[model samples]
Target chain A: MSKVALLLGSLRRPGNGIGIASWLHPVLREGLNDTSSGTAHTGVDVVFVDPTKPPLPLGPIVDGSHVPADIRDPSKHPNPNVREFATFVTSCNGIVVLSPEYNRGYPGELKNTFDHLYWEWHKKPVLLVTYGSSGGANCSALLRSFLGGPLKMQVAEKAVAIKLPKSHSNGSDKAPTQGPAPDWLEQYRPEVLAAVAEFKDLISQQSSS
Target chain B: MSKVALLLGSLRRPGNGIGIASWLHPVLREGLNDTSSGTAHTGVDVVFVDPTKPPLPLGPIVDGSHVPADIRDPSKHPNPNVREFATFVTSCNGIVVLSPEYNRGYPGELKNTFDHLYWEWHKKPVLLVTYGSSGGANCSALLRSFLGGPLKMQVAEKAVAIKLPKSHSNGSDKAPTQGPAPDWLEQYRPEVLAAVAEFKDLISQQSSS
Candidate 1:
């Protein structure tokens, strides 16, 4: 089984970034073209990396006779979550970054996560799935150069951008107050499906070779 | 005096971004070519916008017979700092953004401040002064598009990039731990002066017209 990491870039809850990913997670798991749904997107497991998840307990890992001793091993990170986060990335066959372009740039938390680990990123295939008012065009372009050039990662050609409409008009230009449009998921289904398929294909080739 | 906003993007204190800005602040105040040292930069007032400043006190504005009643005015923002920040931006004739490329992007706090106020940014001349290993090339490019396009702000032609030498060799690609080379300020002095001169010229025209 090929495991893929779905990294959440934005912290906005019920926003378009997470909303779109939630909508497509189950759909992609059943396989895009398979008319009869089977278990998991053709044996591909996606690990959702959300930073909001409660941090690991401060105490030592629970000891058990059945547990592997190395399960408690956390590389060398001062923060347990950061150590686990990096370790989890090593297990993934591919990665899909769900980032929302904020102020024509990507989020800081996303960069914070990427900076924690280095060697695990080399030659790993990454698919950019971004959402924003401009469909995250600038965000995707910058990420492409950074991932492909500096990190030497295999960035997928099928980069997806889910553009959300401008619906907020409260006279202030902060964040959008409301959630996404009612049918945003239905409208962007095809794009999401296509991007996920490309990611699966890349990892599949990696495993086979 | 033509007021300019120097917005600091990165929080690193001894780092290049702030170090370069600190070096140029006084030099610009004295004017580049003038032999006589002046108190201000050719009638241009540069405001340093750092997010780490203490927040405005919760109490009401100090009441005094001699003081203006509205001096304690903070617009409509729930966060007092944000309100004061936006209010202050409106008074500036031009802006200088001091940013560093983090993981190939920019600091989140910078974007958070920009997103807070929209109308204040319209037609405001902005000079991008960025520091990174790539001399903030990608960061400057992205900000140029962002400020010129959506924000509808005036972007300076001479964007300054104080490229720092890659000295952090602790095997982590995260952030440059050490400060810039001892002579980095002297090395990048000419470029920063040129950019600030261009910014001064733009704001001079704004005040004259």
Candidate 2:
């Protein structure tokens, strides 16, 4: 089975990012599980990684020889969280990041996690799903630049951005009440589902090739 | 006198961001101090605000009734740091953000600071000075979007970006020794100085109007 990691980049629990991801999760599963589809894969495994639950420590400076040896060695890292997170990234064949636009950018927690490891993310097929005031286009653009430039990841061009209605509350204490998604999100659902399916196929083809 | 805040967005002290800011500080002061120029302004006062020190707590949710009264009041907040920071922001006539690019974005500390308050940032003029591997264009772009969109601040078109050589070290402990800036930075100095002067003029014009 192909293992895909769904990385939640929001620090708040009851956030739009998570709300959207909650909806996307099943869509991705169903897309991957459908054997009627012409892909050679039987089923795909999805793992949820929340940056807030097991917070990643700030990473070392990106200097070459100057980076502390312990940080360079994931096994020897002083922080167990970093080690566990690294292991999770290494296990995943593909990665999808669901991020909320905070201050018109991706949350710091997400960037911190990516900064922790370099090679672990290399060559991984990645998809971005974002929702916020401006539909998180800024966050998606920055993520694409980072993933393509420094992290050396293969990023999909077809990303999904849902412009959250002004009424949405991104509070930490409560999850958005589960219900049919808002009308704005509903309009994009088909495109988002297609993107997720295409991302899965891309991951399968890349891994098999 | 016009009060301007120099907000440094890096978590690491004695790092490249601070180093670049150190170089830019005098340039800004000189521009602001040169009263002989035609702008209708007195001397300018510059205050340094570091995001890491007296760190700001995550901001309260923007819900109308849910926002804590203390956070809304700014005076009753339990954390003196947040209160002080709010005051500093409110007192400033204009703001300049000096940030280092980390993971192809601005540091979490900077975003956290911005997240803590809303109205204080509104109507302020923000100039970005960034230094990093990609010259912090990504960070600057995201910051501009945030400041312009939700924050309701005016961002200058001409900003400064310094691309540090690969040989530079951004470790936390040691300050880069005082010396003439690298040749690449030297080449950009004139343009950066011009941008700073233009930013000061813009702030003066806006405040006066």
Candidate 3:
């Protein structure tokens, strides 16, 4: 059984990015669940690391947990929240991030989450789900470079973005109320499945290696 | 007189980035103070924005003082931290950001600070002051792209980085004693100064045009 972490970046309620993630969660879960019948067994357990609280810390781990000391002491920390988030990420095999494009990049809070845990983030597989007024295309593209270049995270190619303004409904129901899944979800379902499969395989290989 | 807003990315105490800004503050002040003679007046003021408290709310303002709806019903309003920070940035002629690298990008929290407000960040002139293991090279470069492409910020080419491990010290002092600003600063200072001057001229021209 494999465990997958779902890290939500937005702290706002009724957030467009989170709403999109909610729609896609079942798809990822279903994809993971269906993989078991194949030669490999795939099971994903999702964990959401909330950003409202303090994040993991950097440097040596003092407590019994692999958690850093700064997370426990934010006053002396550059970004305790990011460190704690990194600790959470370290515990997971793979991650799916619900990123919101703000000012044309991943939110500052999300960046802070990574800044605190540089080494722990290396080699992790990340699937980004983004949404913005511009469908977050530019944000997701630039993010690919950062995650791939510096963090050394293996970001899955088949990602999803909910193009805002065009996709959003002006009616009372601003949320995705189109039911089971939107047409766009169906269109990208194959890539999403393939990415998750690759992630599971990578995790399994690393575990054995 | 030129007013430079020093927006310190990391709000932590005794942070090296902050310390560097502190060290440089006097030099800039002296430069400005000393030039206030003969024919012209030269003065510089640097203000730092602290992201620790409740920020002002977003929305249209009638007199640049209050948001009517929020004043009437604070409970119905979204968080205002982003709006307030944007407001501060919009008021400034130029900005100096003391950014620390996180996962090869700016801290998410700091980024979120801007995400919360798009209108205020559209045409601002921003300068980078970053540090990290790689002297925050990748992060700074990526940040420049995001600022220029999405946020539409005029990013100053002149930047600073404090490479780690090599710069690490065993001294008991809380703040790490960093060597002199990287030589890159000298190379980019004129470029950045020109960008700032040009941005200011452009903005003034637009308003008067």
Q: Pick the candidate with the highest TM-score.
A: 2
lDDT of 2 by residue, A168-194 (tens): 644333324378755666688677766
**Largest DockQ belongs to which candidate?**
3
Q: What lDDT tens digits, residue by residue, belong to model 3 across residues A49-153?
A: 544443422221112122222244323334454444555666777778877665567755555555555566678778877776566776788678777886788
2 or 3: which has the higher lDDT? 2
Candidate 2 local lDDT, B1-209, one digit each (tens):
78888887765543566666667777677766766653545678887765545533433222222333215555544446666777777778888898877666766657766766766777788888887767888788778878788788888788988777766644333324367765666677676666766777778777878
Per-residue C-alpha lDDT of model 3 across residues B56-94, encoded as one tens digit per residue:
222111121222212323232244544455556656656
Model 1 over residues A1-209: C-alpha lDDT tens digits? 66777787766443455556675566556553343432224566766766566331112211111112113344655456656765777778888898877656665456545644556677788989887767888789878987787667889888888666664111112233345435644676666666666766676676667
What's model 1's lDDT at A146?
Answer: 76
True contacts kept of each: 0.12, 0.26, 0.48
| Candidate 2 residue spans exceeding 4 A from truth | A38-43, A55-80, A133-135, A163-166, A169-193, B38-43, B55-84, B103-109, B169-192
The prediction achieving the highest lDDT against the true structure is 2
lDDT score for candidate 3 against the true structure: 0.56
Q: Please list the C-alpha lDDT of all candidates, in the order they appear.
A: 0.61, 0.69, 0.56
Off by over 4 Å in 3: A36-39, A48-87, A133-135, A161-173, B30-41, B53-80, B133-135, B157-165, B169-209
In the order shown, the candidates' DockQ scores are 0.11, 0.27, 0.35
- Looking at model 2, the pairs that clash are none
